[model samples]
Target chain A: MNKKSMYGRTARKIGCYAALLILAVIFMFPLYWFFLNSFKSYEQLFQFPPKFWVWPFRLVNYLEAYMYPAFDFGQMMKNSAIITITSVIGAVLSSSVVAFGFSRIRWRGRDQVFVLVILTMIIPTEIVLTPLYLIYSKLGLLNTWFPVIAPFFFAKPFYTFMLRQSMMGIPVEMDESAIVDGCNVWQRFTHIILPQVKPTVLAVVIMAMQDQWNNYLEPLIFINSNSKQTISVGLTFFSGMNATEWNLVFAGAVMVALPILIIFVFFQKYFIQGVVVSGVKG
Target chain B: MKKYTVKEKRAIRQGLLFISPWLAGVIGFTLIPLLLAFGISLTDYNFLTKPRFVGLENYITMFAKDPLIWKSLGITFLYAIISVPLQLVFGFLLANLLNQKLKGIVAFRTLFYAPCLVAVVSSTLLWKQMLETEFGIINYLLGLIGIGKVSWLGQTGTIIASVVFISLWQSGKMIIINLSGLQAIPTAYYEAADLDGCSRWRQVFYITLPMMSPTIFMNLLIGLIGAFKTFTQIKILTDGGPSNASLVYMLYIYKTAFTNYKLGYANAMSILLFVIVGILTVFVFRTSNKWVHYGSE
Candidate 1:
C-alpha cells in the first residue's frame, strides 16, 4: 500500500486500457469505415476528406445493388440461406453422431482411425479440388447444390474431433449404465451422450454456419451456372468490374456480411467458448 | 483373426454403423478422387477431350517447364512466413494485454474480432477500395504526411506487403486462441512468482510462456497452414495483378485448371502443393519437442 508502487500500478493500468482502446479502434476501423462508406453518395465518396458521419442514410446504392439485374442480391440470399441452413444441419448431426461412435464406443482400431482422421485434416482441400471436380462432373452433379452440400453430411474431421473430445469427457459410467439398462447405441447417443455435449454441438453449429456462409472458394469452383451461384461470387463480380461503383460495392459487402455479424454479436459467448475448447483441449 | 465376445462384436458393429457416413465419404469423396488425382497427373486431360496418358510430362512441365510454379511457390512461402509470425507473436502480445483485469474487456475483445467475422469477399472488397491506386483513402491519408502515392496493390514491390496489410487485423482468431490459453494457466503460478520476488517480465518468461508454449505452437502450425491456402482476398483485390506478381500458388493452380484447361497439370501441381504443406507440417511437428512444453502439475 506504499504510495510510490500504488501510483506506478495505477499508471500501468491506465496505459494498458489506453493501449487496448487504441488497438480496438485500429482493428475495428475497416469494418466501421466499410459500413459508413456504404451510406455515402458518389460525390461524398469522391470528396478529398471523406465523410465519416452517416448522415442521411443512403438507400439508393442498396436498392441499385439489389435491382442491379445481373447480380440479383435476393436470389443470392436465398441460395446462401439454403446452403448455410442445410450445411449447418448436416455438420451438427453428422459430427455429433460420428463423434459418439468414435468416443463412446470401444472398438478395435478406433484410435488408429481417429488418428487418421486428424492427420487428414492437415491436407489442404486444394489438393483434392481437381479430382473432386472430375468426380462431381462424372456424377453429373455440377451446377447443382449437391456438391456444395454433400460434403458436410459426412463427418468433417475438425468438428468430429472437437465433439469427440467433449463426448469423451463425460464419465464412462453414464453411458455404460445406459447400455446395461438396454439403452441401445442409438438410444445412448441421443438420450445421454448428445445432451452432455450440447455446448460443443452449439459450437459446431456456429462454425458450420460460419464456414458455409462465408464460403467463397468451394461454391465458386462447384457451381458454374449463374442462377445457382452464391452471394460471395456475385459480390466478387461487383468488385472486380472495371468501372466499379464504390458505393454499390460497399452496400453489397454490407449485405453479405451483416447477417453473420448480427449472429456473431448475439452468440459471442458460444463463439469464444467454441474456439477456446478447440484450442485448450484440442 | 482372433474371435471377439458377442458383446464386443455388437459394440464394433454399432461403432462402424454410426461412422458409416464418414466411411462412405472417404470412398466417394476423398479416397477415389485422391487416387484418381494421382492417375490424372500422369495424363493430359482437358474437359473437352479424353485424358491421354502422358506419363511424367505434367511433372516435368511443373518442375522444368513452368518457372511460375517456383516463383509462385516462393511467393506463397514468403506470404506464409510473413503473415503467420505476425499472427502468432502479435496475437500473443495482444492476448497478454487483454488478459489484464480491466473494465469492458469483453467489448474490446469483440471489437478487435469483428473484422475476422466479416465475409472474406466483403473484407477484401473493403480493402480493395481503401487501397485503390487512385482516390484511395490510404494514399489520401499519406498525402497529409507528404508521402507520394504508393500504388499498394499494384506494384510488385508492395503487392505482398499490401496483401499482408489486409491480413493483419485478422489475427483476431489467434488472439482469441491465445487469450484462452493464457486464461487456462493457473493463477497460482503468477501468485507464486510474485511471492518469490519475480519481476513482471521474468514472470512472463518463466511462468506464462513455458505454460503457454504448446498453445503458441498450435497457433503457429495452424496459422502457417491457413496462410498457405490464402486465395480469396488476394484473388479479389489483385487477381494476380502487375503481371502475376501477387499470384499465390493456389491461384496459379486454379488458373491452370479453369482458365488454361490444364486439368491434368493442375492436379499434378496440387499434389506437389500438398507435399510441400505436409513437409512443412512435419517439420513444425518435429521442432515442437524442442520448445513446446506439455501439461504441467
Candidate 2:
C-alpha cells in the first residue's frame, strides 16, 4: 500500500512539472520565433522545415533594415521618447493634482464631479474618433503631436482613480499636522501627498509610457506626414508592398520592445506593486 | 495672522483654482469631444460633406437595416467572451503556480510579460509570418509532431482562434496582476484549511478562490473592455480577412469611417458600442457584489 501511494505521488509531481513546462513553452514560442527570424537571411526565411536555429547567422539584415531608412532609427527612437516622456509627465502631474482634490477637498458638487469623471471611463475612444478628428482638423492640430499630447492634460479617469486610492491610504493626520504648521494646500500637496503617493505616481508614469509608446491608431489617424510619424505609426513602413520583410520586421520589433522590456526587468517590483495598488481601487 | 471667515472661503477657492488646468482639459477635450461625437452621430456627417441634421437616420440604419453591424457586434462579443475567460483562467493558474516562492520568479514573470511590450507592428508582422501556411514555424512544429498542416490565419474557422492565441501570448501583465492578487491573500486562511484536513482542491475552492474574487472580477472587467477595443491586431494581421471571418466591431467601425467614408454610420456604430460596453460593465459590476470579498469585511 505504501509503495502504491508513493507511485501516485510521484505521478502527480511529474504531471505538475509537465503542465508547467508545456505552458512556459507555449508562452515563450513567439519571442523565440521573433529572435530566430530576426537573425535569418531573407532567403532562409521561407525555407522548409523552417530553420529552427538561424545557424550561419547573418547580421546584414539588421544593418540593411536600419541603414535603408537613412538611419531614422535614431530619430524614430527620439520621437517616441519625446512623446512618451512628455505624456508621462503630463499624466502624472495632472492626475495627481486631480486626485489630491478628490481625496482631500470637501466641497459641493465634488462627488458629482467625481462620478462624471468615472463616467468618462466607459466612453469608447472610437465613439469620439470622428468628431475628435474633425475638431482636431479644424483646430489645425492634425499631423502634429498636439492631438496626441493634449489628452494627457486631462486628469485621466483611470489614473485619477488610482491616485485617489493611493492618497486615501495615507493617514489624514499628516495633512492636518502640515496644515496646522502653516503649510497651505499646495505646499501640503507638493510635500505630503506627493511623497506618500510616489509609488502610485511612478506606476502611473510607467503605465503612461507603455500606453504612449505603443499608441498606434492615434498616430495613424492623425499624422499624414512621414516626418511626424511616431515609431508605432512608422512601423507600418515595414510592411512592404509585395512582401512583408520578415527579417527586418523582426529586427524593428526587437528594437522597439527591448527598451521597455529592459526597464521592466529592473523595476519588476515597483511595476507589480503599481498594478496591485491601482487595480485594488481601479 | 487673519482668522477671517472670508479668508477660509478664499483658501477653498484657491484650491479649486489650482485644479482649473485639469478642469479645462476635462471640459475642452474629453467631455466636449464626447458630446460632439454624440451630436455628430445623429447627423449625416461625413468629413468631406457638411453634417446635415438627419435626425436618427444613422441610428435607424444601424439598428434596423445593417446586418453587418449586428454581425460585427456578435463577433466582438464572441471574441471577448472566449478570450477574457481564457485569459482569466490561464492567468489565475499561472499566478497560483508562480506564487510558490520559487527561484527565478521575476525572470519568468518578465518573460511572460515581454510579449505585450513588443512593438505592435513588429509583433503583428511576426505573428503574420508565424501564421503563414507554408513557411510558418507553427505548422513546421505541427509536422514534427505528425499532425497535419493547419492554416491558422487562412481558414475562416481558425482565424479567430489565431487572433485569440496571439492575444493570450501577450497576457503577461494580467498574469502578473493575478500573481500579486494571489500573494495579497493571507496565508493563514489556507493554513487553517489545511489544519481542518481540507483537501488541496477544497482549500482552493473555499479559501483561495473566495479571497481572490475581487481581483478576478477586476480582471474580467478589464479583459472585456480591452478585448472590445481590439483593432490594431486585426488591422495588421488579418485586415478582417479570410472572408471577413475575424472582423470585430471596432475594426468594422474603423473601416466604415475610413475605408467606406461612412462617418455617420461609424459614429452610430460607435454609440451602439458605447451602450453595449456600458451595459456590460454595469452588469458585471452589479454582479461583482455577489462574489467579490472585501478583506476588512
Which predicted model would earn the best DockQ? Answer: 1
DockQ of candidate 2 against the true complex: 0.47
**Chain A of candidate 2: what's the TM-score?**
0.88
- How accurate locally is residue B82 in candidate 1, as Cα lDDT from 0 to 100? 86
Clashing pairs in 1: none
lDDT score for residue A215 of model 2: 89
lDDT tens readout by residue for model 1, A91-151? 9888888888898999988988886776667667777888989888988988899989988
lDDT tens digits by residue: candidate 2, B1-297: 645477657756765765666678777776787778788888887687888888899988888898888787878888887888898898898878766554566566666777887766777788888878988888888888898889788754577787788888877767866876786777888878867979889989988888889778868877888889888988998888867777888899889888898877777777788788889989987988888887774
Deviating ranges (above 4 Å) for candidate 1: A1-9, A176-182, A239-242, A277-282, B1-9
Estimate, for each residue in B1-297, the C-alpha lDDT of model 1 and write its tens digit.
899999888878988988887788777777778888899999999999999999999999889998999989988998887888877778889999978888887787778778878778888888877776667788888888998888898765587787777777766666876887898788998989878978999998998888899788867877888888888877887888768888999999999998999999999998898788889989998998898888842
lDDT of 1 at B173: 64
Candidate 1: residue A188 Cα off by (Å): 3.0
List per-prediction Cα lDDT, in the order shown. 0.83, 0.78
Instruction: State how far residue A135 of model 1 sits from its true place (Å).
Output: 0.6
Go through the candidates in order and give each one's DockQ: 0.62, 0.47
lDDT of 2: 0.78
Model 1 chain A lowest lDDT segment of ten: A273-282
